[model samples]
Target: MEILERNVEKILAVLSLLAISLIFVYIFKNSDASIINWDEEKVNLNINDKVYENLYIDKINVPPVKAGDVVTITKKDFKLSDNNENLVFRTYGSTIDVFLSGENIYSYGEDLYREGKTLGRGYHIVKLRSLGDKTSDLVIKQRIVEDMSYRWVDFFKFTSSNNIWHEILINNVFGIVSGIFLFSLGAFGNLVYVVLFLITKKNNLHLSYSFATMFFIGLWNCTTSGIIQAITGNYEIISFLEYFSIYATFVMYLFLVALIKKKSGKTKAIDIVKLLSLLILIGATALHLSGTLCISKTIMLFRNYALIVLLVLFYTLYIDYKNQKKYENVLLIGNCISFALIVVHIIIHNFNLTEIMDITNDNLITIAVLVMIIIPLFLYFLELDEIEKYEMQIRVLKSLAYIDKLTGLGNRTSGIAYIMDLIKNGFDYYIVMFDLNNLKEVNDHLGHDKGDEMLVNFANCLNSSFSDDYCKKIRYGGDEFIVVAQFDKVEDINDNIKQLFRVIDEVNRDGEKGYSLSVSYGIASSKEFATTGYENVVKLADERMYSYKSEVKNQICET
Candidate 1:
């Protein structure tokens, strides 16, 4: 029955993990941080022979206004007739129109401009005003009105490329799937650690660091997609969300760096890089929001550079993995290639260069992203098992090297290494050498077993007294020990030695032992050694210990 219960629990755990993984995959695949923007609007105008040869305005800005609002065409600059007949103009979408003949101008809607219609072949600007109670703005688009003799150039048509739309959809779909897979792979490592912690009842929260990193990634993607969806039709909203997500992406990368260098305390470099990327994103966003359409178009060029950074990261990871095969960070490489492909699609669309590769412009990149999500997810699962085995080996090796076999205290080699580190770091410290008063006598009288007990007890006392304090205790030899620590003055060192002696005296007075466990301690400080090496200082401490033992012997003889 107990075995059945355990099996059921295991099944439940597996099911829960699978469910969460699927949900995460769904979120990664379906989310997007892009808004829909309307393609340019086009209208056709008929030109009469009389006024079509005169002054023309190419574009105009018309704000939201109610009916009967007299729209003004501020004699805005216009292009000459395409063939010396009609002029074409791009204008803001308002509910108004302007009549132009030479320098003559009048404002009205579809009616007044009818009079100025002439045998011209060019574009003209017209303002618009609303006819209803509620005022609304229009997205002004270019229109071409033709006359009997209208030139071919005057027959303007604004067409948005369907190819661009297809490319965006395909690239984005692929990207989404791939991204989710990569994320899931990374999460597998954390899941393994979390399960181990649960089974052992140990607070091994190391995996939480990675979890926090991936949680931010998921959060950022979720926030970006929702914002993009909400701002689909609002220009201001779209502009704001674009820059926000771009900056957030950089911040996420910086956070990842922090996770990798857990203890380096060099987070400022990450902050600086994040700040620069944010500035670039903000600057591009601002240029887009301003009236400069060309500058807005230029931002796609900057995005190409960001893609380059992703490539660099991919190669760096590959190099690291070569040196240390343990790091199979597949997401870094998978996402890099996925994003690179998407960028290629973008470039092809922007420049009409589709001959290089069999690139599809129908959500192919989106699908690529989706596919990438699986790479991380599965890779994470594999990495978790490898990491556990590696950590186990490390623990075993460390135990052999640093732990004393007899008493479990720090071993002689570890003690020497610790002191060497302190010396290299220029720490002024005190070394207290402790020797068992009569270990040979105890061994001769009570056999090696009793002597071993005395040694164990002595080691335990050293560990108990100094382990929780400022001192580090080590089993220096068979019947010798040492305590090392940084001290401000010799007086502090003296007080600690006196406390050690008092503890030994108390133990002896209590009886019940074969030869009371007592130690003769010698203290040496860096300050007293002046220019001497650590070896010389240790020798001095040992000599002092013998002198103290001699005094104790004399006192015992008198008694």
Candidate 2:
């Protein structure tokens, strides 16, 4: 029944994840949108003051133009069916102005350009309205800065205001949801760490690394989702976050890898990897900030470098697994899967393959990265399981150490420790020493097993006489026992001794066993023993117990 319930729970959990994934797919896929590929369309380009007609946008073989040069693209005989619709074009590396039939219609960054200002390196959206003409000429003039290698305009389309809003929401839904989910999970992980730290007062390195990695990855997802651009409408801020997130994510991942290696006690190789990763991150950040490298181009280069780092990390984990480091196995499996997915994504991305399930290969790689982040949480739980097992074993060993196997009383080792603790804490206690009388006679008459039976009866009588709250009983050694009782006065110790005699009498009267149990005892108070030390007090008690045993033997001989 329990197994069936557990299976049901597993099925429910899987269903929940699938349901959420389908919801994300639905939100990201359902939109009435169109993309006009410039590669397939006939366009004309004016590069470096030279005009080339009937050229494919992708096949344009113009020389690279210097900074401050002008480039124009003219698409003649263009037809417009909806005059009210907006024509949106995404462009890079230019300040653009749209002209319809040689008349100015829309200008992008013209005001900022005239003010001798810059919006920095980013993609800008240029929008213009149609003239309701069946056939008209469209001219796009751009003032190019830096090299013209990154200059391109594509995804041009006529869309209504409502349709445009739907397209933005649909396109960015996956990113926004994924970012929020990853960030929330990371934050929750940090919260759990805070709670555990408060309870255990130990810093856990894995949790820290997992939190940092997820946080930066979440930031990258949000920035790349396009939702930030849609909400803030600030391309500069979005662009900066986009580039910054890339470096931040890489740095945090390196830290996570290094931490894992450190935990495994194999840090030299990962430390080198961490140093190299940091250098690359720093170098990329410097180049982007110094304007020596554009954001898009820098990110492109970094991606290839990152792939190498990932491969190196995978190899390291593989080596660890080969060494039979059980903890590294999960990491190896997760990294292998993520690496395969990322490789496939890189291939599809580089070849410009068609997207599946309305998700680009880039999005697929993001999913794989998320899987990597989640794997650590599973490992953390596995570590917890091992810790719990270790604690259980320690508890069992502790039981064996302190408990007497025969009498179920505290053992001799624990008795001495208890006495020392009482002395150390200045606790006032009465030490009672006992020796079983005639145990050898009982063993000779019946058997050693019968002697053990008498010993058990004596232990029971001792337990019945003293409550645990005020007294502790120890099976000190063979045919001997010791009990420590806390009391304010000597009269209380006398009263307990009287009660002990009564309990022994009752046990003998019951006659459950063939022999009657008898014990010789001597008591010593802490007040008398404090000046003589607890160990000396125990020796004094042993001497007094032997004296009492001689008295009992004499009384037996006379009777």
Candidate 3:
């Protein structure tokens, strides 16, 4: 019942956070519906510029662009924008060229297309410098690779060079912000995993792989959003990272699940999937780098592969979760959520019916990716907390088993273990055995309570005397106690014995109780008795204690 309640609390907490986020989104969307006016900034490039709000485009299958490419051309007669302003074209896998009054002003990816190389995409910002000022003819020629034709430049934009980044950020705040958040979470998880691994020294590699999976997922998200490419304009590196991150995510996630299953004593069926993921990365990267195929074409293969693997994993984890209550329960939850979101996204994208109940599922991928990482991470921490509590309970039980109820010192069982450990290490130590005097008489005449009090008081004296790092004090039995210590010299034993005697005298000063505590002790040093073995040494100590008790009786008779 308690476990169910804890799980419910965590689920409610996550749902509440999502509700708060939806509220914020609602407020942001409703806050402003007006169009933005950029002319209010100090750099009023649009003031003197002849910026047209619309452009006329002609779709042409054309005289042919290779065999499968799509070519589009647009021509217009209008006044060119101000020389200070620039025409920016945000394009992907498309070769774009601008002509002002029949003279070339800007060209991008033309050589790549000519050389039959993949034109990885980024923004092409063109400078307008004196195109004869009068009504000039503008022409834009474009060629898009067939596989990457989905990403096309939809419109012509003119802005100052300084405002390009500002516009990019304004357009992609959510992507950049969410990307940073996901990446930050991955980093924090890594730090936590490191600390936890150092402390526990147990099977915890799953967390590291899980965090690595999350890191790459965030990298892919941010890079694919085009914000990083817009900022750096290094489309090649950003595109490489985007492809590499998918491969890494696939491999890391497989490893994470495999480790979890292995820990749960499951068979090694997932290793085949792990190998397939690795082969996909290696083969696709080799082909893409060799110009035989584009990485974009491999995305379909990855998606199909991921769908099959996730279904299998979902079924396996679900069965395991139902059959047994284990840590993998959290993994199953994350896996199911991700798979469901992915299936929804696939259906929406394929069927072209993204609008459901007046809401478009544009953020499904982001939500799925974040949910896949966050849910597992949160629930894993909860599982770890429970494991720590179990360990604490075990420690408490062990401590109770080794401790004496009446005296608080170690009991006879613990004393034997302590001495055995010392002998195992070949240490020269001294054993001091103590037997409380007149305990039987006190129990018979003054009652057992007073005898128990005397026994406790003497144990307290022994504790006060032998409370050093190398000393082990134990209540051997009823009215019998022992202190085993590693001392540099026999002289140190005498000093400790004197200290014990001093404490005993102080404890016996309670005359109002009509009783005093007394103990006869015997000392045996391992240095002298080791030749006879440890068992004989203990027997000798017992005999010497009885001899001392006899001497005490004789002295009392003389008095």
Number of the top TM-score candidate: 3
RMSD of each: 14.4, 7.4, 7.6
Tell me the whole-model lDDT of each prediction, alpha carbons only: 0.49, 0.68, 0.66
Writing each residue's lDDT as its tens digit, candidate 1 over 1-559 gives 3344334334433443475457556645664424422122232222212122222221211122322233232222322222212222322212233433332232222542344321111123222322233322222222222211101221122223333323233324433343343345336645765675567655423234334334434333432223233224232343344344434444455445434433434445445555666566667666544533222233354456556655554555554554443434565556666676767666654554334322353244433433343344344455455655787898899889988988888888888888888888888778888899889899999898879888888877776556545577888888888888787887877766666666677767866676788788788887787663678767777888888888999999999
User: Can you write out model 3's per-residue Cα lDDT over 44-107, one digit (the tens) per residue?
Assistant: 1111122333322111111212324544443345455442366655555667777777888888
> lDDT value for candidate 2?
0.68
lDDT for 117 (candidate 3): 75
Runs of candidate 1 exceeding 4 Å displacement: 1-392, 489-491, 505-513, 557-559
Residue 539 error for model 1, in Å?
1.5
lDDT value for model 1: 0.49
Give TM per candidate: 0.49, 0.64, 0.72
Off by over 4 Å in 2: 1-84, 87-155, 163-166, 255-267, 282-294, 318-321, 325-337, 340-361, 374-403, 407-559
TM-score of 3: 0.72
RMSD of 1: 14.4
Give model 2 RMSD, 1 decimal.
7.4
